[model samples]
Target: MSLDLDYLKLKIELFLLRKKAKKTFPEDLSNLTLWSQSTGLKVAVIDNDGFNLKTNLESIGVSVTVFYDYFKPVSQRQEKRKPYPFSQYDIILCDINDVASGNDGFGELQGVGAIEALRYNFPFKMIIAYTGNPAALSRRIKKEKSSNLVDKIYDKQWAPEDFMETFKESSKSFSNPEARWQFIRNRLTYLDAKEKEIDKIREAFVYSCLLKGNPKFLLRADAELENLTQSTLKFLQQGSMSDALRSGLSGLGLISDVFGIVAAIKGT
Candidate 1:
């Protein structure tokens, strides 16, 4: 019927499915699997060599969204390159030497500037600087640490185990369900623009459904997803975000990737 009702229905269905998944899943499997898609700690690795490090992080249950070529999104349009973005990632591992491209207005210190910006944007989240050369931690880096602009400065060359250990020591607010549905809760969150709006709806659905699987809302999750997906919007942006959210829920294991109890009725 209405957009709001539509949205709620998708959420309720997703919630019910997760509950069902939990009950029927074998005991040997970690309950963490159900939560891994979204409700766990997520990380963003912004080194030129981030992918190399990404493999290590994933092994440790860290879902990493990496940025290289100056922390810009790979395969994305050039216009989306400016701000560099901070995903829903709980932790940030940034390399200082060559990534920011002066977006932060600091030439050699752009990474430090990014840290400042990230700290400002997410005051409560953990931001770690990948101090490539530990022997030469820069003056600006040290200053930020003293002032707490960054939670920690870690060397990339360190053993993976040691790095994560250091990462854990740097913040009290971070955690890993080791959980990947861990949606890594990959939300700032995955990338930008029209696509960004769409993803936000997607993330909100997964994040909310997993955390608040209340039955009361089940009556009208309709307000929440389905109608929102089909609603004739004056603006494309409004449509994309909600529709994208419905799509995201399906990816996370909703009853229908088609996204709604209404199902094929929309086409008819």
Candidate 2:
């Protein structure tokens, strides 16, 4: 019997290709109880002209509370702004340009001053900085030193529909802790499904090599298999509690792969 090495290699490669083409599961919020029709997201806007923005948000099932002006005059820009009904809002939108017009002690409180004050003082679940400025959002964030505090930034110039779509994509603006937990649970569930699929494919490939009576094939393929295993483990270990936890899971994956390889060979 001829050992068609080329055909075996082709089969392995095709199987590997399919195994590597992992499905990207987008974040699904449908499972969250907060997504119910009556439970519209509560949003707050700190913009000079937020009527239209509020309307846009409300059209998509958000309950908006607009604060016409963001920053007060020099004497009134308190270290801590009076807290609103915390239970009501999931997100706060601050227009940077609205901050540009505020006279806070030294001069007009520009973007940086406004961002610092809001980030430090405002207690909101999420803060999204928005402006009509032509500068890129990254540039604005860096300039204002609001990288840590600002969850997202939006360009008011973007088409209204595009703006809303991008907001939905980037912001996890959950209504409550339970809702956020549900979001994470959804991701973990999808990840678990992907890992099981990978395990089956890896087992089949190992068995195929063993059946060919090609002991050297295992040596040649081990590194590639290890890479795939590591990738899968890394995906599973996302949002892990610590580096130690991630390392532990990775070690477990290696052990499982070894056991799978041994089992495949023994079965053949």
Best by lDDT: 1
Candidate number with greatest TM-score: 1
Alpha-carbon local distance difference test for all models:
0.49, 0.48
lDDT of 2 by residue, 207-233 (tens): 333322344444444554555456556
Model 1 lDDT tens row, 102-198 = 3746766567666766765554345778877654555765655644566567877788788767655543222222222222233213322255443
Using all chains and alpha carbons, the TM-scores for the candidates as numbered come to 0.45, 0.44
Every model's Cα RMSD, please?
A: 12.1, 16.8
Tell me the spans in candidate 1 whose CA falls farther than 4 Å from its real position.
1-39, 69-81, 102-105, 135-138, 141-146, 168-172, 175-268
Candidate 2: minimum summed lDDT over ten consecutive residues — where? 24-33
Candidate 2 residue pairs in backbone clash: none
